[model samples]
Target: MKGIKFDGNHSYDAYQLFLNSYSIGEAEPNTNLVEIPGVDGAVDFTEYFGGVTYKSRILKMQFTFIADRFGLNAAYAKLQNALNGRRVKIVLDDDREYFYTGRVSVGALSPDGQIGEVTLTATCDPYKYKTKVRTATCYGHTVGKGVGTVDSPTVTLIHASVTNTGGAPAVPTFNGDKAFYVTATERHAGGSSDTFLNESESLPSGKDTAISGVEIPAGATQEFGFCCVGEGDLTVTIKLQERSL
Candidate 1:
């Protein structure tokens, strides 16, 4: 009954394949070391280059494909077609709440009578992403909680509507850092059904649209609201995914 789901296709149901064994490779650190002329050990430049970087993780799975209604050759072909060179989301039966994204390489399939054993190696990203995407609604200066072992870099803003009550423009802030600016023309009046005008528009001049410096830290509650040059009220929804090593 133990199997893997690759790109939304169940291995057992699709190819009559069952997981026999598996192994996960640890994330290797990407370090820079300099060998000195007479030093006992190499000088580590990992900290100098903004801390340690992580290489891609590896997941190896051994599966036994039992020929049922379909012949062994047909089933093996199906499995090859599904995973050969495709980058997909891989979800193991043991960890249903997290998924790894990578390209699966199908190894040699050794056939014995009606069964064939195959090895699958997945070169995955360093982190596993949560299956569920969490949402946080912000009303003015609202705070939201983050749950994960690592910080998430992807944050999306949606259903954003702003009302500028003061004379100056309002800029959205996440953890006291500027996100984007809202001009007077983009503001919605009180009781207006129209959303903010700059929902999908690019940021103001010299501002990047990609949200940065606003990552949700692991197990921390951060404030995500607006700071006005005068006064403003903003209503928006934030969506993000939690990731871990």
Candidate 2:
């Protein structure tokens, strides 16, 4: 863990500093650098005219303790052993350059005597990089529209190259190289009868708000979002789960 030469005042070498400064989580040994920002004499190119932005994909992996009761039993112990300390890997497409060697903790455990909904927060490594995000457009076709309550303007759409940007998804797999998995389709206050809506999903895994699906109704901003690292001929189709509502 030593070799690079430093000028002065820098506590550690750039490599060491970089590793400590940014976290890819213990489970993920490392993360793909989206961009270097100011390195290599790279200028600030923020748009299509400036240049193109290709960002590293941020992915999430989840584990659950599906026990019917509280701990102190073989079940709880089994759950602990399953994910108490585990390494997770996020694979990048094409080049095979990916991140790996991270761990999981039971820290998301709920408190005792807490019945019903006991939700614990699972904290993983925050993702950081200096890459660009490519801008792409997905197609959408309505399935169940003009239905539901008059007050509630709901439109169930299959994953039609377009669905949502962010939602409280329990899984962490992408639809393709640039799309996350689509979920239960419902209504959206998307601009008029026929048009595209602007939806924004979470950026990678560590920088802002954690939002479940948006409550599409009056007074809501149409969002803009895309899937994670989806590969191949990316085609999205989201169907409304009748069992849901």
> Which candidate has the highest TM-score of all?
1
Q: Which stretches of candidate 1 lie over 4 Å from their true place?
A: 38-40, 136-210, 226-235
Number of the top lDDT candidate = 1
User: How do the residues 53-163 of candidate 1 rate in per-residue lDDT, one tens digit apiece?
Assistant: 689999999999878534777887888888988899999889987789999998887888768888999999987776222223334542221232111223222233222
RMSD after Cα superposition, model 1? 12.5
Error of 1 at 19 (Å): 0.9
Which sections of candidate 2 miss by over 4 Å?
A: 1-64, 70-73, 89-102, 112-245
Give, for candidate 1, the lowest lDDT window spanning 10 residues: 143-152
